[model samples]
Each structure stands twice: as C-alpha cells, then as structure tokens.
Target: MPFYIRARTYFKYAEEQMSLAEKEKDPEKILKFTLEAAERAVRALWAIVQVEAPKEKPPLEKILAEIDKACEPDLAEEIKNHVRRIKELAQNPSVEAAKEALILSRQVVRRTREVLEPIIGPAKRVDQHRRFYF
Candidate 1:
C-alpha cells in the first residue's frame, strides 16, 4: 500500500479511537483508547513524512529530523513536543492526560495534512452533479 493510504488508515483509526474514548465511562478504557489514538496519529505523521522523503526507510529519529528540516521551526517543535508528551502520558495514564493526548493527536494530524498537501496536491472531492463523461 502507498504511504498516503497507510497514513490515512492510521489517521482514521486514531479518529475512531478518540471517538470511542469520548464515549467511554471507564477511566481506564478512556486512557487506553486515547493513548492508542495518539500512537496511531503519530504513525500517520510518520507515514506522511515517509511519502515526502522516500529515498530510504530511515530510522524514526532520522525521519523526524528530516521532517523538522522540511517544516517551519515552530511547527516542527510543536510536533516533537506533542510526541514527547504523548509518550509520557502513555507511561502514566489519566483523564487529563488522555484529553491532552487527543488534542495533540489532532494537532499532529492537521500539521501533517498541511505539510502533505503541497507534495500530494489537494485531496479529491466528490460532487453529486459531477459526472464522468468518458
């Protein structure tokens, strides 16, 4: 599968997990789902970066460094900070931590899309009035 497709799949899973976490009454379940969602979002960002630079499957640290160079300094720093915080939250789960993870996951996904749009062009749109003549 293509990198973008993989990224989309992971992003979708992250969104689903976040939704599940929101509805969950049990704190433990919420934490579990939120953490998973955060992790998946990170993976999606990784895949997006991979699509931008496809020479070799470099180590994650190297890939992150490449992404840092490719993106604005503030955006790169935000992503790095989010990843670090998400990992820390994973280690010690809490309702607040889960919420933070979900928020950061969303930020990462938005940033990734911003970075990818230029390289991949805009995403396709479906319209009811549009028809294929061919």
Candidate 2:
C-alpha cells in the first residue's frame, strides 16, 4: 500500500480502537484497545516519516532531523516530542498514556499534512486537448 494510504488506514484503526476502549467497562480490555490504538497511531506516524524522508530506512532521529529541515522548527519539535511520547507510552501501555499518544499522533498527522501540502502540491488533472479522427 502507498505510504499515505497505509498511514490513513492505521490512523483510522487507531481512532476506532480508541473509541472501543472508551466504551468498554473492563480495565484490561480498555488497556488492550488503548494500546492497540497507540500502536496503530505510531505505525501511521512511521509511515509519514518514511514518506517525508526517504533515506534507505533511516533512523527515526535522522528522519525527524530531515523533517526539521524541511518544515518549521516548532512543528518539527512538536512532531519529535509526540513521537517520543508515543514511543514511551507504547512501552508502558496505559489508558492515560494511550490518550496522550492518540492526541500526539493526530497532531503529527495534521502537521505532516501541513508540511507535505506544499511539497506534494495539489493534484493535477490532465485534459486531452487533441481529438482523434478516423
């Protein structure tokens, strides 16, 4: 799958899982779903990083640095901080941690979109000007 598509899919899954977690009464199930959500969100961010910085599977830090150069410093820092928080929370896996991760992941996605909009630009629609006559 394309990076954007995969990232979007993962993010959607994360959102769904988060909703499920919220509705569930059991603590264990809530944790499980929350962790799943966090994992999906992290995966989505990874996809975004891969798309933004194509460097033969570079380390996350390197990718973040590349992103920093490509985008605004504050946005880059926010993304970095979110990635760090998500990683940390992924290790522990708690409801609060998951919520934090989800929020950060959403921010990362939004910021990534903002950064990529100019780089990717609007989609071009080609028009066929010539008519073939037989």
User: Best candidate per lDDT, number?
Assistant: 1
**Model 1: worst 10 consecutive residues (lDDT sum):** 120-129
Off by over 4 Å in 1: 51-70, 116-134
Q: Each prediction's TM-score against the native? A: 0.61, 0.51
Off by over 4 Å in 2: 1-55, 119-134
- Cα misplacement distance, residue 35 of candidate 1 (Å): 2.3
**lDDT per model vs. reference:** 0.67, 0.60
The digit string of per-residue lDDT tens for model 2 on 1-134 reads 56777666766686677778667765556556655665555555566655553546445565555655545678667767776776666677666775665566556655554444444333222123343567
Per-residue accuracy of model 1 over 73-102 as CA lDDT, tens digit each: 788778778767776777877778777766
Pairs of colliding residues, candidate 2: none
